[model samples]
Target: MPAADAGGTPDPLRRLTLADLRRRTSMKWRTYEPDVLPLWVAEMDVPLAEPVAEALTEAVRLGDTGYPAGTVYADALRDFARHRWDWDFPASRTALVPDVMLGIVEVLKLVTGPGDAVVVNCPVYPPFYQFVRHLGRRVIEAPLDAAGRLDPAALESAFARATEGGRRAAYLLCSPHNPTGTVHTEDELADVAARAAARGVRVVADEIHAPLVLPGARHVPYLTVPGSETGFALLSASKAWNLAGLKAALAVAGSAAARELAAMPEEVGHGPSHLGVIAHTAALRHATGWLDSLLAGLDRNRRLLGELLTRLLPGVRHRPGEGTFLAWLDCRALGLGDDPAAAFLDRGRVALNSGLPFGTGGAGHVRLNLATSPEILQEAVRRMASAVPDTGRRTREDP
Candidate 1:
């Protein structure tokens, strides 16, 4: 258990200096102005750990920047899986993917065809709907329950209906779920696995946010379910380690169906970047303390954000996060009419991920990232409160 400094100071292990973040933002956000606080993207403001940075810097200096070939990152990934999830994944069996979305695209191509239906839980990662439509596959949404938790009964019912309808439906599972931060329990995952297995449906579990789960909340890999050896798992430290620029991810599949679906025979040129492999390996092998610190920082940030919102704006309700640093806020109480995100941006000058894009159920909502510093989180909440009139007085403790 790595810990952060009290009073919201950056932990030395997970220190992401403001200077490096400033430099990185100039190129990435295009709004390099020092005033803007960027919480829109999944990337965190934290600096890379010393070990991870040193590994990449050393690899670059050694002139190791060539086409990746062989087990540079494989062993590190195996060790990471073993230590973090207690799951054994043979290094030899894992496939290197340039990006997680690319792997999802590849799997979609293999499992479904034009007019085939691909089922997704609503208010999901935008890519879940985008990928299926990109490949001419019909997107079928099985929405999460009112509690914002994935409903196993709804999922099972949907699968049975799809099976009866003769439509080939593949499920995309997001754990420690993005945008909402709900961590699926083992029993929930087991039920999903059982449903998919019984219905002859393939499940693509996106466990990218697994590393950010809070202390008490656990993220169960879809493959850990009994008889789920064949389930496909798309995992990467890119989200956890904020290595999105490196463009590296892992695709895990032990079952014959998963293997057959994930394998891309035509794309010989697509492989992991040397820097990505080096950074990933280093982070997995040596950056455990740093990661733990980040998880703690994120958890604290989540609490602080909630407190700020509850004190300042009563109508905007949010359920405390179970995982991930993102929180889904119900802004319907504020009569912003439609597109509350746009109204907030116009009045609050803060850019939040709009809920409508997630699905109909997500309307009148906004997704905020609490992964940044306490200062930034407080400022965002202040701006949001100011944007909307404080008519009601409700605090987190009131309920």
Candidate 2:
């Protein structure tokens, strides 16, 4: 457990140190050399909530590692959604899958056949391309606008091309989008729903980051929109509670699309670990306080990162998006060529995700993870500043 400050508020998350985090066996720590500071992966540097840990521990003690079964996980999600987002999520409309990406692939198979087109917004999650391609589907990209927000015009054009020649197609929506952390506004989502419906495109929303929405931002479920009756959404407690290793997620369908969700094969459910279901259910049902504390800590880290970037890497442009702890940085001014991430990793020993892999509009960019302690974030920025050539000349003078 984390110690408390003078205010009696526990700030355990802030107490996390590089030395302590390095001891873990996770990929984030092991992917790079010992001396390198890894801010690449989406994993956070926070301890598990007590409820989640307890549930996992209890499951282990009872040797409950059999195959996953039942609807407890979906029910918990229902309760949590009702209270947190004011949305009535029907448990009957959901199916359990190993994870969000897999659930999306399964849903896509139901809606479209092999070689059908699947649309994505690039400078988007790299996996959106990988998994869709693995399923033998053609990936059509609708790039985000200059400010990293959804552009309805771009989407409309992509939908037209994707649905041409009477071809079957599906749109993979990443709400509270990855890499850029852009939270889709209600108006924007409604527009998307309307556009997709008009083009005969089925929408599958990846809302794994829905729970991680910070203050001043709202996460509106796509199915809740007026014209989204035919859409499906993939959700999980993994991102918000740092339970990615759990391998559990809910594939939810709109009332009119329930049959598609029900058609998902039973073998898909077998992929989720039994313990993962227990932990995720506990997280959604009994871990709101922990989630709240994490949101507050992330809010601090986001602001602190901006200050660090402004002072240390003035040539790099970053506008903190409305949700998620990922910061998409534009490093074109630094002249790091096509891949700035490589330069940062090679020179600064900071491993960030290369924006090149995210596709068009990704060159000269890097995505930095902002889920660590302020101290670590500060060190990362400092090391990054040192990595750039003529850093002293590029920095902005303090007012």
Candidate 3:
């Protein structure tokens, strides 16, 4: 007997197996083998892009698995940056850091200090809050407005309050926002930049998921906005190509102010992995079509899951996801006790991110990553609908 071969389809969204459709997703971190499905973690089950794998294999075959040094590595990264995002990222300003978290820490070191206040949007990536606290800075939650998108006025208010309190220094921005999946508009980014600049706050934009943006949504590079040069851009190939293990990310600084943020002592002395260099270049050149196919697959899964939730369990409110693969589910109407994460895990046998960690407003919600196959989503939804209490439900309009 032999294992069946799934088509070497570069697209991860379309591949689903009968087993996948039957299993529950797991969100537990302690145990890798969850009895239920495992969708809680951000990692995807897809194999690496063929080109990325080939590049790594070729690098290993040549036995060049040492620390990166010299101009060739920088040139490869520069070329990829120019081609992929259409931005003129100067290779000179780019530093090959080991990972994005390190980049964030370094930026925090430079732009802020103990007793300083760091502004971040609510329901953001958890690390944004952690990074600020780890650096001994106070966190000011400038939560997104009612639309689940950045509200410029709220940001201005937060900035003013921080200034009045004399704790302002840095702001961390997630472009294609996490948890909520709202892609910020150009005007929104500009307003944030203008406000931050006025209050002498430097912005660090984490764009790790920029490459994974869905169709019909434009990704505006933070530096592209006027006065954006006052901010630093943090990006990585980890999320898009699933190369996180290779551990190479870039910190791109446009203006002198931003460059100063990147040149902190804590940021220095880190080395880049040779494999990350090779894979990133291969992905930029050969994986464009693959990325497009994957995005389409993600979009389909998102819609399918939304539709299923609507029909089977009407109270679960979900919008058509705009950017990232994450689906923000409003499970307030289910009324299955207070903790939705625990309820879904225990009763539904589906492990999902608890919405409370995202912020107070995220309470009674759950964040589901739709990056997996359609079959998996179907089963996950099935478990959820089964576990949810039978409260008389209403459609989206009833809310």
Candidate 4:
């Protein structure tokens, strides 16, 4: 077991230093040069939770590398949801999928069709645009409010535009939103459900980040809201438990959407890795303590980032996210043009995610992963601060 922080929670982020993290071969680390401090991707620096690791190890030891069986994964999620957020849904209403994004694609197929408009809150997960367009569906943007909250008017406008010509449309919602980390409040979600219902638009919420909701915020399951019984949700332990590489997720159907979910090809359940299912089940069933510790470390790192930017890189603006270990940065003030991440990587040798890919309102912004050690976070900020041009100013006056 690891030592606990002042909050009496194990600081998972503290367990890995830059040196230790460098050994990682994941996209988060390997995408950049070894000398660069990579903080662009969602992969966390912490080791796997003991329970999850033990489960996978046991599975392999017994040569249980076969297809998944039973509703154990969904049952575990149900227990976690009920305990954590007071939410519940019968296991029969869920379907196993390869992963969240693929699951989203599958669900979208059931709700919308080719040439149909699929609405998304802009500056969202880029994959939303990619997958939707690839499926031959149109991507309609409904930009978020200035503070990164969902905008009712924007949604209404998009919904109206989408349902034009009596076409079926779907709204792909990112609850506990990525990059911004805005956890949708219950009232906000209720409004979304009502508005989406009234507009005849199906809601497909991606709540993969639900379990990672930080302090002072709560995650409202979109399906739990009134008027949302016809919607669908994609949930997974991938983001919360660092199991993205394992690849397994659940597709949940709202009460009225259950039949539509069942219409999904039975073969879809065969896509997820059997081991991935086991790992996710173990995480939800027995890794709550580890998740809590990770939340503590993330909370601390978010605060630390705000302070670092204030002192070291004043030109950059960041609002600490309400959930998840990601931070959206407004680097527009830095005069680095639209893609400040490029500048940071080239000059500072710190690779942060470019804002260009995140869609409207994303330019001049960057998405940073905060799930690393305090030392790496501090070093990354220092490198970013050094990357800014001085404009021929004297000591302490430069960026």
Candidate 5:
């Protein structure tokens, strides 16, 4: 059970039981056999936020399912930014897209061309590599610094090489980044904008996890940084609210980039589902209280995972991230060789995301989801510790 919050209420992650989760048909639960505990994937185990569920129910009752229209989604997001991050943009600066990754593809098209270079910080989200290659664009690697923060030197080198022949290049930045969950700070983002501007590299930021930032973190929207006026940002409530099944996102342009967003083809705006728009907007505007509860829950889980690792696994190194429900564990010390998740699945009956797919610096690491019940997380760590060969646990106590 989750410890009660300051107000004596249990957070969302503990609301569901193992049997309750197995009944669902989502990929997270369905991917593994019933005996295998799933700590991979970004999906949360919590139920829908009340406001979002109410909004969807009301829409269904009124038979409001149809094509997406108007700027309600954008309007809701703008309100959220104003209150949460002290940032603001006019309705004229936003457009609807199918989702964050697809929105990134469209933005990349607006700024780059076929065979051009797209730079990404390595050990990043796997889709960044896959999608860039699928679009006929080359991916240039700029690995993060040792502490998992964006490395300015690496970015400079990558930018220099990407535009070697004066060919157009784009940087696909993940803000409040996935997998590692490193929230880029204002100064870091400012440096990126300046560097990209100096090197003639256009920037497209994916801020899907902005709303998922936990306590002690302030997620700076890339477009809000100085010199970022020409860059673009793509955001959605899908990640923070666990509404991935709904397909809708908003693309926001800085003051100097509005014209580029405006020039997007008319057909490009037809992909968002109306129901998705309603749910996303509802989540942004009305479910903020629920969001607060979720953040509290996820923060607790993050620390809990670290505690379990120290006590049972010992060899694993986990630095609890400042945001999101993902914790990146370095299992190199355990001698798991490149892909420890494979061993965990085969020997421990636990499913975790292999880190190899995240590019450089990913080997010997695994990304674990912290958005589940505390009891389940405890069990998963015990199983993972048992997968290690012949080493006495470095610690012997359970909180």
Candidate 6:
């Protein structure tokens, strides 16, 4: 359980239980069998922020749910970015979409044509490959460095290949990268922007996890870089505030990219939920306190998970990355084969995301969600340790 603050208030995030969480009907809870603990999705187990809940409640009371209108969401994001990230996002250059992935796809369509190459840093977010390919575009790989950080040399190589044959291409960048939780430093992002500019490759950054950056790290919005004036970024309060089910996101265009962004069809804006815009706007505009508390809880959970893994699953190499609630675990040393998530799911009934789908560098890994209560996190590690086969090394007390 989370300790009480100075005011004696219990942390809401730490108060959840497996029994309570299982009652929800989200995919994270419903996809697995009755006894399985599902921790594969990006959903958090925390309750809604007070302001967001109130906003949605008011909307429901007034029956204000209709087509999204006005610039409230964009205005809120502008204020949030200026205050939180020191980025002066122009609300005039923003557009709404259903979610980050869909927004990225629409942006890709605006910037690149069919059969154009799209570069991604591998062991990356799986959907980057899926959505790009789904648009009839070719996917190009730029695998991360061994330490899970972006590799400029690899990216340069990928950009070179992506722009061959005089074909236009785009780089699908994952800011505060998923699965690995690696937050790209400002210097790294600047380098990416510079290289992409030189190679005539447009950069599309997915910054959904921007506001959830843990302590001791900073999130550098890619569009803020000097050479990124033409790049586009996909952002959403959904990820930071756990409003994924609500479905609203913004596609922000850099100063020079406004023309291309304006080219996005108006029909794309129709996909966003009006209530989602309301909830997300309220979150960005008035819920920083709630976001701060959530970040603190996530920071604690990340550190706690590290300690737990050391004790219960020593061979499962892990280092809590800078941001997000996801932890990438190298399970090769556990002798669990290439897809370690499969072994854990079959033996321990703990459903984790398999690494194979992340492509390259992902063969011997599993992505663990660290957004649950401390007790559930502990139990998950214990179950994972117990699931290892007899052929693998075990603790002294193992029967």
The models' CA-based lDDT, in order, is 0.75, 0.89, 0.74, 0.91, 0.91, 0.90
lDDT (Cα, tens digit) per residue for candidate 1, span 150-194: 888778877876566666778888887877888888888888878
Candidate 4 residue runs with Cα over 4 Å from true position: 1-9, 391-399
State the weakest 10-residue window (summed lDDT) of model 2. Answer: 3-12
| Model 3 worst lDDT run, 10 consecutive residues | 1-10
lDDT (C-alpha) at residue 361 in model 3? 73
Q: State candidate 3's TM-score.
A: 0.89
Clashing pairs in 3: 24-36, 24-37, 25-37, 25-38, 26-37, 26-38, 27-351
| lDDT tens readout by residue for model 2, 170-228 | 99999989989989988999999999999999999999999988889999988888899
TM-score, one value per model = 0.91, 0.96, 0.89, 0.97, 0.97, 0.96
Off by over 4 Å in 1: 1-20, 26-28, 31-35, 258-262, 266-271, 392-399
Decoy 4 TM-score against native: 0.97
**Ten residues in sequence with the least summed lDDT for candidate 6:** 3-12
Residue 177, candidate 3: alpha-carbon lDDT:
86
The per-candidate count of clashes, in order, stands at: 2, 0, 7, 0, 0, 0
Candidate 3, residues 1-399: lDDT per residue as tens digits?
211223334466555453553453332334434467767767665667778888889888999788766545446555655666566756676667777877877777777778888788997878777767887888888888878988788788877776675655778888788888788878988888888889888888888788877877878888878888867888877777767667777777866664574466643535567777778767767776667777777877877887888788788878765787788888888886446878888888888888887865778888897888777788888888888776625554663
- lDDT tens readout by residue for model 5, 146-245: 8999999999999999999899999999998878889999999999999999999999999999999989989999999999998999999998899999
On residues 34-71, what C-alpha lDDT tens digit does candidate 6 reach at each position?
89988899999988888999999999999998999978
